[model samples]
Target: MINHPLECWLNLRMDRPLNSGSVSPEELQAWQFGLLRKTISHAVKSSPFYSKQLQGVVPDEILSPADLNKLPVTTPEDLRKNPNSFLCVSQDEVARAITLSSSGSSGTPKRLFFTSGDLERTTEFFQYGMGPLVGEGETVLALLPDSRPGGVGNLFAESISRLGAKTVYPEDPSDIPTILNLLLNSRASCLLGPAIHIHALARLWKSKRLPKNQVRSALLCWDLLPPVAIETISNTFGCEIFSHWGMTETCLGGAVECFQGSGMHLREPDFYLEIADPETGLPVPDGTSGEILFTTLSRRAMPLIRYKTGDLGQIISGPCTCGLSMRRLGDVKGRLDTDILLPTSEYLSMAELNEIILQYVGVLDFKVNYQQQSLALNIALDIAPESKIPTDLSRALTSYPKLSRTVLENNLKINIIIDNNDGSISSGFGKRLITSS
Candidate 1:
């Protein structure tokens, strides 16, 4: 019942006993080194960006993973300023081009080019990564766009079809009723989308007492999924919830979680991942929180070497209870630049705030802002009045030491506003904006 040739290819690959985790450290290092050498050679010869960046560095000199530090780290600024220079192939050879908007003040977007082979690799990853949640003959409802070629939704749909499953994508994700109708009519067993959108739908489905149909699992992709959001969605839907971690720069399908829920297992064969000190660019020990850096091993159109992802997280090295030996990625704690500064020079991360605010029972969504010597927390509620929300939120903030000090010293005042507008909350794609001012 294989629907795509790549499905067979993935099945055969997965059947191999010598997977990333099964191999000895020496064997894995040797394999990674070989791939690294090839990637370095390809990038230096084909990509103008790498050629100039790797001027005096020789590919053969990078005999081990640590040797990667010999080359300069590639930053988002490099991609923004000279994107085409990173392409290993000509424009005609590219199958798709994706533009990722920069998070900086300039607001410039970085364009990434992918060849047919690159797209196929992504499709293959999706087919296998999604294997645990979806089964043959089941329908998967994707709440992402399908209008454009190579969009995450389109690629996901194609992969689901390849796995011998049905996929339904609503014409417009903003239309919640239509989306819910499609899910119910299709009897979709699996749901995949950004965490925020899925959270909203889960609440609506619960409030309306909607029929669950065959829905069994949900995969929250694209952005960080706070623990509160996960618990809420899973409780509302009465299903297992999984998290996926990927970025446009890596062709989107990177790491995914298994049913055991230990952590998001790394796609070790296709991409080499490293946790590095953001300030020093030196590799950090496993279990240490730091920036995520990666090297593309198999991409043909564009090969990014030592590319800094700017994501903040640690790598876990213990054997997963799920029987996976591949290193797992810890829960992403938001970006390095997403820290909120206080008047006392103390810091609060958006991830931390999200964990606290999302725990409040009637809180649907929220945003934070600092202005006029006060910190305002705008919240979207599933309930009315919103009078007790500010007091409730203030009490919650007291649980955090740094926030409590800020409040006690009167260095900052806490304010809460009820915002029903969709614009105030995130649209469930890209990075969540934590502060407006």
Candidate 2:
């Protein structure tokens, strides 16, 4: 079997002899454990927060991966409280500081600081991660913001250039028509953006009667990739759909999928990933869904030890045909903070609703509101309002097993309001959530 592109990239980074063959899973685990201990010692000696938080702990004592349970997990609140405390480097050494507002009701924002070396490492990861998406000399049009000096899109553009591929960006990512025209004119081989934006462009492409096969593939990131969105893009553009899992903390390049599409292989050399019981904070067995946590192995400016991501995921079990031994992370289900609790204590995840609702035709995007035993859906359709779409969408809502049970037992009323606009109303580049209107 051929080695996965990421595994090949890792070999280059480790400088292993080409004749030595691919690294085994056991070797990767040992390398990660060794680096974890080294990183812990560095963090304890440098970062103020880690020094006090891990006061009594000895880094040398953490000999195995399981020993990480002895350390306390870091939360978003901790970072928001004092980001400077997590800094391991002096202020002069820092290259970029990004302030990200909280997605939840917490008005305070958390800031992440990265040195030039850190940003360079992320750019390298992005370079290798794009192996499965585009080939040399191909053009990748990113429908993402690139104005910032070291933003995610900027880093992606840099990485694509390093890969010997061309990168193009629309004048305004929010303008759907501009993106469509750029795709038609540029004839870019790849499309990279949020899942919804790509889906909307595909919907518009189909509605406009444009030619298909302009894009050979797409790399969807910055948000969850719904199956419905994948099917729509694949059908409309005749392109392969690839999804990536990462966040601001991971420098936006954590895990990526190969052509096999089994799961997203982790950036094991840089990040040591773990899945723990969401409530108990204990490591769960592989394949068990739980909160995702990771410890940085190669961070210099700010090292997050046992950081709780608040996103639900699991480590995939079984061997992949791609011949990579690195652990792969399953699709991230949803955020713990975004799950809406119903009257009966049952929870409805936004991912579940998106899977069912986004599959319907003419349904571009929708905002969910639940209050006082009433569930109102403010839906935006690409096509003009049809008399039957609202009823059909309402029926799809109650079809979920958990939701159907909750509605009947709690007398939940369903309301559907079809917005007359062209799906641009809910096209913001943020995580979709249920709001109380």
Candidate 3:
């Protein structure tokens, strides 16, 4: 738990009007229902897409969260098909436009628009979300893109500046020596970037044998931070590592981890989150893994009603030790589209594979390749030459009854190749694809 006085002081300073975590669930629901009605009315009247999507459904009819399912889901394909139809504001009124191509997409990319007020709300969320880790007089080194106006990096810098802190955004983050110099010279207290990039820098810092413990804290975004990666980074920098979950659709500001680090505290005041069956789109019981569906309650430019995020996770209820009443979300368990299919048609989630692989000693990184009648696991090990595959790992894999039976009944070939060269494993900004032909 965080220090009580400090948390209170930061909360007061941030002056967040919707710290719904501090209120009762009933109160939060009432607040959310009111916002939902208003958002629905606005979107239907302004956005051609929502106007057609919500045909015959009165905004007032959605009095409860469950009734929200009466509306159809807005999918990425829908956004890509005709993005202009989703816009509530005119093109001239748009403050920022972002084009993103989803993995495996070959057609037109999905476009998202945000007004100046929308961007300001995201910045405000960042300001409040980061208050616990960042404070006055500290320098935050942002390793995200900051050149474009109204981009995520620029908004992040603005938010830090609003909190009376200086920000350092590298023009080219690939240049390691330059970033090291900036970190050393500026005496930066907080480091924020994708997990892969931050891990790479930490390894580079260790390889150079630089002075120890320069950074005070680190916030990793964009990708999931494996336990080993978090441990290595924290050890290298001698700082606590935090994680945040969001997407471009949400303007890049969403749930964040408090000092407790149990789970990500949801930004319920701005968005209402629900866990639903990926196939049926019906709400699932709390703590049950399901697809994450969210509704934009405050967004003006492109308000989404029950948007299917494709990401997988569960909603955690109960009070947090940090004293925040907001609900939390479990660690994202990869995407639904990326699940690996077996010969027997059984699906293996990447999160399950990650949990098993990261526990082995001397394992640095790994990639999974699915080919004709075979599953190849290419692993990068930290061990020296002559070290063979651990017997314990073989036993652990076979111990999982489902996997063991599938491997035997289907006669599926499982090959494990251990490579000592860490460079063989590649990292990306978002979900890393493990499947290959």
* Model 3 weakest 10-residue run by lDDT: 377-386
lDDT by residue (tens digit), candidate 3, 1-437: 44433234334433534332255577667778888899999999999999989989888888886797788888888899999999998889898888886655455788999998888888887887888788899999887744356575699889888889988876666554466677878899899987656665676566567766678789988766677667767878888887888888888877888863678877777788888998888899888899988899889899998888888888886777777656788767677778767666777765566566655444434566667445543443332123456667766665666568766877555666664433223443457555656
User: Which window of 10 residues has the lowest lDDT sum in candidate 2?
Assistant: 379-388
For each candidate, the alpha-carbon lDDT, in order, equals 0.74, 0.79, 0.73
Q: Estimate each model's TM-score.
A: 0.88, 0.93, 0.82
Candidate 2, 178-269: lDDT as tens digits: 67888888789899888888887887777777878678888887787888888998999998887778888887788877752578888888
Choose the strongest candidate by lDDT: 2
Instruction: List candidate 1 segments past 4 Å from native.
Output: 1-21, 145-152, 174-178, 211-213, 372-391, 398-401, 421-425
lDDT for each residue of candidate 1 in 83-181, tens digit (9 for 90 to 100): 999999989999888887765576989999999888888888888788777889999888764335556457877888887997887776655545767
Top TM-score prediction, candidate number = 2
Cα lDDT for residue 391, candidate 2: 50
What is the Cα-based TM-score of model 2? 0.93
Residue 228, candidate 3: alpha-carbon lDDT: 62
lDDT ranking of the models:
2, 1, 3
